[model samples]
Target: MGIEYKRRYALLLAARDSEYVKKVYGGYFNVFVAAYGDEEEEERWDMYRVVDGEFPDMDDLQSYDGFIVSGSPYDAYGDDNWILELCFLLQALDSMQKKVLGICFGHQVLCRALGGKVGKSDSGWDIGPRKVNIVNSCSLFETLFETLPALTIIECHQDEVLELPIGAEVIGFSDKTGVEMFRIGNHILGVQGHPEYSKDILNNLIDRLLSQDSIEIDQANEARSKLEIQEPNSKCWQEICKAFLKGLWNEYPSIEQ
Candidate 1:
């Protein structure tokens, strides 16, 4: 038999591993792998910390089957050098029609790179579990979500996509944000919530933000309170993300082109 190549994926990490995450989970890479990777598969996953100026070699981009962009504390609209470089990389990936998944800041930056508009949310910060209503008209909705009407996910962001790129479809939304999830053809997906985040992670982040005076005591308390009452539909989200990234939906028709 001929040699078989292992499937590979790239994580374009846009944020550093926080002290808490480093101590608890080894790093954000481990956390992401836990959420999206299949322990059974013999796949290879590489991480590129774009925030720290590390990036994958352009020549090796084609070897990766899919790419994921992680959330970041930085504003996606800022003209920072790394942000600009990330935009260029994303554009190249788009041209290659590689599968790419963006989360929060990743979602916003993906929009910005693909000729869409992104900016601060007029609704202020959304730092708790929120319901994101599925758009029934999206072609993949029936196949992926079936009769599910909405998804509850943990969210932490102040920036949002103001306009979508041409050919992009809004697949999910919520009362607080207009574009909660979107897709471009079969290759690109963007989510504005933290489907990969756990309650403890959010709690720690809240504490850090409070210490930095980023959010008031009452706001943090309210976020914490909401967490106690309802939990995120993490299992459902994991399926959705894995399916999109791993081409599990190849049997279905393309949602957009």
Candidate 2:
């Protein structure tokens, strides 16, 4: 079946990329990306500008078969109202039985909306790729998550979900954080790792960070060093992506052949 007739997915990208223009998943999936934040990229993420200081109900969102929440530099625990709204959006998607995947900050949003709490990490910043253990097994994780061993994931974050939302299940974790992955419902999945990000995307993020003076030179270098050591996508990325996409396919097979 053609992508036009296939499942429609929507990516809520919190971070914008400027240097990269016109990039997509490069697959059969039909999805639209919406970026948030004041940071601008040479290539806009198709972010919606709220003139009335309120976001409209995007029809694409309502029809989306799946949702992917991208990582962000903003903290979910902050006083920003947008972050709170995004959290509610995630919960709404979950309640509607839509497939949702949250990465990094997206992961924290999932936790917080589920009656969970988010807080600063006492273990310091987590930079680079690291091994994450699958906490339990389920169909949502059948091929992708269940029994996955020490999968290396790209990570760069200082805050974590200190508490789990009510009825939330922990899918994976590590020594640094108690919950590495979680799911609110059967079809919703939230991972603290960046499985969809290529090293190039990470680089764009770094460039934006540099321009914004978000991180000192030494800190950026340190994180870059750690990212290399983490060696994201060293087979782990491909496997995880394959598993994740496959899981989605299995969940809702295309209507056409």
Candidate 3:
């Protein structure tokens, strides 16, 4: 389905507009998916080989200008062999100062890889377009819409970042979930919300999760209700994308323009 590809491509296009860089997908997805999303090769990527649960080679990671760790359906604290391997890979990538961006489960992986703790949250599930309060200034928040009410983003996750990775800056947060977002370094960022999700994409995702039994039946419907599904806030996304892009390039200005 184009649902998954559309969300992924949103991030890809954002990176494309912000200067120029070659991208590589470092998650687990089939190669055929690359041709399914878009026609522009440079405007898209096929990044599934990074964690194929087989023999993941990091050689491709080195050639890319930056990397994105896409969201996954698995829980980070679960008893899975691939989770540990992915954590190790993230840690190694961090050492190289790779400009890494992790979404949802990927964010949890960054936390675990860098000595942060992640497990089942007492809050159960954080779903819908909840408010993520800003705590401190970071690259992800530059030129962001902080003045316009709360940043209600599409968030879906059971495991939250309970601990901050070594020297990680606490950025935006939500009252519902304390650690909604954070940053480990100048180049590494983790977002708990789905800024990449359009309203339709998010609604469809809820349906898929319910059908596949990945999430509880009751919770999926409730999550959909909270999505806010209103105006298309491409500006909010610009704040996030530009911040991440500048952070990746280490181009933090004295004042956010």
Candidate 4:
């Protein structure tokens, strides 16, 4: 038998695992893997806690087939040493045409790194389940998903992308955020919501935000109420993300129909 090649992927975690997440799900790494990873034995996923100054060696970057940047509590526009280094690393990854999937703060930072604009949302925080309208003109979306006009996702962000990078296209948007999702060519995709988050995780985060006084009591209450009414299209979003990262859309029979 011919030697089989293993597919390797990396998760560039940009946030610390909250105590609730640690205790409940083991960690954010496990949460992400559960959402986006294939169960095949030949696939491997590695995590680098970029929030804590950990990163893959520059020379080893190409060994992985894809990279995922996780949501963070930090501002994507901040000039923290690690943030600057991460921007540089993203730039390098961009030049190499590597597949990169950015979530929430990851979405914003990827935009900033690629010469786009990002800043605090004038509309304030967007928390809970939101309906994001998919752009029908996006060939990528057409190739991957059925003719669904929109998808609901859980969002928790105070920052948003004001302008897109050069040559970038907005693939999804919502009533609250204009750039709910974007892409640069086929190699980079950025999503403003958390597809990997479960309702419990978001509930825990909402409680944490209330405890920290980061959000007003009324806002927290409203967010929690909304969560009870709507549900995120998590499975659909996960399928889209996995298809993008693993290059599985080409094999999708929908394209031939």
Candidate 5:
């Protein structure tokens, strides 16, 4: 073999490791690792609970090959100290041309950090499995476009990217959300859905949302019903995300390649 190399990735966890997540998925970190990590490879992911004010040091930023921002219960537009700090961190990552992937709250926050507008959706809350139509605008991901015309992903968010950042472009959309996915050149990408979520996790979350009065009984039931029949293309999404993070622009190439 010529050489052995491994790419390091960090998960900027924006939510607390909930009791439910821990009980069901062995913690939120496990959930993300299960979704995006190569289990056979021991040296891959790092976790930082940013919601708890934990973050990777600035000097160590160059060590990671890419970063992933997890969904949060908190508003991305809020002026909390940690949120501000995370925004500054994101700006620095962008400047360094380091790859960053944002999911849900991460998506909205990245937009906010990079000169975009985000707010509560005028169309209201979008919960459960949603089908996102990939747009053909971004030529940079032609292979991804060719592979997946549309993808169904687990969505649970009220905030959205209303106006894209200075150089961001919408690459995916859904009926409920205008900006389902966006890209900033090749280094940054944001997705408004939880490709990491499993049906059981979403079901548990639905129950919690119902108890908290965040979603109506009918809406929750409808979302569950759809999940009974439709499966989100988690595999395809994993490929796309891994490709972007690994700096593969060809055809959603595998990480090992």
Candidate 6:
């Protein structure tokens, strides 16, 4: 008899869920599953709050087909112990040739882990629906994103990837940040914006940021106004992510040395 197997993925979350997410979305794990999982496919997703010291065991790395890192409030370049440990974990994933997708802080940390540079953005905060230009479209993602010249995604970050790892290629960028999306080899992809976020989620985030004084009231209002006027291309971003992780691209160049 043939055995049935299902694909599995991991979420290396770098932050704790906000009370709002927990209450409204049933936590960040569900939010990710909703964004990345195929409703028809019998795939499994596991969450590991790496910020809380939970990580997949070294022996179980092969059990997962891909890994996705979640955004965090913490700075990617911070010298915290957990951040360093996450870097080591990312390096191990790269060595194993496992697919890893990073978002927001995840994007910055992946670059740092792979010998790239990440630091505070000199242009200050980038909030709201930001248009990211598709500078290079390889065969893998061209048709998947419908060949759009630019895609807007929700952005809320103060740090940016200053340099890419040696073989990493910049596939997408924005007016505020140079490196919006980067791919390393066939296994690693990083996106600087939040594709999983809905307008409501971003609005909540803006409110929280304002309450904490991370952003001024004027900035928050402007971002909220933009959200009301134009929506981010969430469907396109989700498809790009799905294609990248599901190995839909037939002719992507290898970034490996």
| Per-model TM against the reference | 0.95, 0.72, 0.70, 0.95, 0.93, 0.93
Q: What is the lDDT of residue 227 in candidate 2?
A: 74
Global lDDT scores for all candidate models:
0.90, 0.62, 0.60, 0.91, 0.88, 0.89
Prediction 5 TM-score vs. true: 0.93
How many pairs of residues in model 3 come into backbone collision? Answer: 2
Error of 2 at 142 (Å): 4.6
Backbone clashes for every candidate come to 0, 3, 2, 0, 0, 0
Judge candidate 2 at residue 142 and give its lDDT: 62
Winner by lDDT between candidate 3 and candidate 1:
1
Say which prediction, candidate 2 or candidate 5, comes out ahead on lDDT. Answer: 5
Q: List runs of model 3 lying over 4 Å from the truth.
A: 1-46, 49-51, 54-56, 137-149, 212-218, 228-235, 246-257
Tell me the spans in candidate 4 whose CA falls farther than 4 Å from its real position: 1-5, 250-257
Writing each residue's lDDT as its tens digit, candidate 6 over 1-97 gives 8545478899999989999999999999999999988888878888999999898999999889999999999999998999999999999999999
TM-score of 3: 0.70
* Pairs that clash in candidate 6: none
Least accurate 10 contiguous residues by lDDT in model 4: 248-257
Q: Single out the weakest 10-residue window by summed lDDT for candidate 1.
A: 248-257
Per-residue lDDT of 1-257 in model 5, one digit per residue for the tens?
A: 64343778899999987679888778998988778777655446889989989999999999898999999989999999999999999999999999999999999999999999999999888887889998876788875575566788989898999999988899999988999999999999999999898898888889988999989999998889989998888777876787788777665543221
lDDT of 1 by residue, 74-178 (tens): 999999999999999999999999999999999999999999999988978999999999887876556765556578999999899999999999989999999
Compose the digit string of candidate 3's lDDT tens values, residues 1-257.
Answer: 44332223212111111111122232123211231233442334434433346423677556444456666667766557767777777787788886667777777778888989888889787766776676645544453433434566777777888888788987778887777778876677787876665565566667766777778978876776565554434346435544464342244333232
| Candidate 2: tens digits of C-alpha lDDT, residues 1-257 | 72343344455666544435236443211122322111222222223322112443744566555666666777878657677677677777777777767778878877787678998899867765667876546565565444345666777788899998887888788877788888765666678877665566666667766788776677678768777766654344434432352244244322210
Off by over 4 Å in 5: 1-5, 40-42, 253-257
